[model samples]
Target: MSLFFKIPFDKKQIELAIESLELQTSAELRVYIERKKKNQHFSAFEQGLDYFNQLEMFKTEAKNGVLIYIAYKDQQCAIIGDQGIHQYVTEQFWQQQNRLMIDYFKQKKYNEGLINIIANISKELARYFPYQENDKNELDNEVIIK
Candidate 1:
């Protein structure tokens, strides 16, 4: 599936959502849209981790990077947060985000799903990794369509 054709959500909306979220928090947030079919040999979680590393999400200054990875063809997505944020959030929190996203996806409301997820993540990130004066934006707001 091509990123252009498979992702039903508007690229501009997604980028705006990301920008709004990151502006309020110091943590880096990125959305990666996978054009390839989900690898049968790996679970969504594994594939997400792979992309997270490939994108060097773990290299953030505060180690508070988060990746929202979507495998559109497989109808699966994964939310991965680096250790700085993970250690403060509970597993249940992550599960809840996943459930909400899955629910929206089932209804073909991909844009709403991503916006909600980014909002929720921003709240948590603000709580733990509040923006500091010297904090720098570690990543781009552009949605990686690959």
Candidate 2:
């Protein structure tokens, strides 16, 4: 069953945001939305971890993949960073990003929330993994909806 009474963000808005963010850095960011997993007991973080692998986020040349997983029906979400990015950022940084998203989510501003998070992540990525001459986009910019 579709859970959202009002769509969080239009598909083009998300895609353009992601594409714009990606242009500034080498880090790969992907958003995945699932409507309540069949295993309803799984936590948002766990599901995100599984999707990180299932989505082949680890296959990047620099291992710098980030996943923003949202279970719309359950109103739960997790932001996951791959090993390359995690090594440079602290746990607190991730918490801050998560908190930022949650704050906007509370106000029903999913689009702004995502754009803020993406911009922040792009800043950090640029600092740690600036784009190189040969750096190609390793992941798709589209938001995955299921």
Candidate 1 shows a clash count of 0
Q: For model 1, how does the per-residue alpha-carbon lDDT over 1-44 read when each residue is reduced to its tens digit?
A: 64446567788999998888877889999998875545768877
> Which candidate tops TM-score?
1
TM-score, every prediction:
0.91, 0.89
Please report, in order, the local distance difference test score of every candidate based on alpha carbons. 0.84, 0.83
* Per-residue lDDT of model 2, residues 31-145, tens digit only: 9976676467777888899999999999998889999987766767788999999889787888888888878878888778878888888888888888777778889888888
Off by over 4 Å in 1: 1-6, 35-38
Clashing pairs in 1: none
lDDT of 2: 0.83
Best by lDDT: 1
Residue-level lDDT for 38 in candidate 2: 45
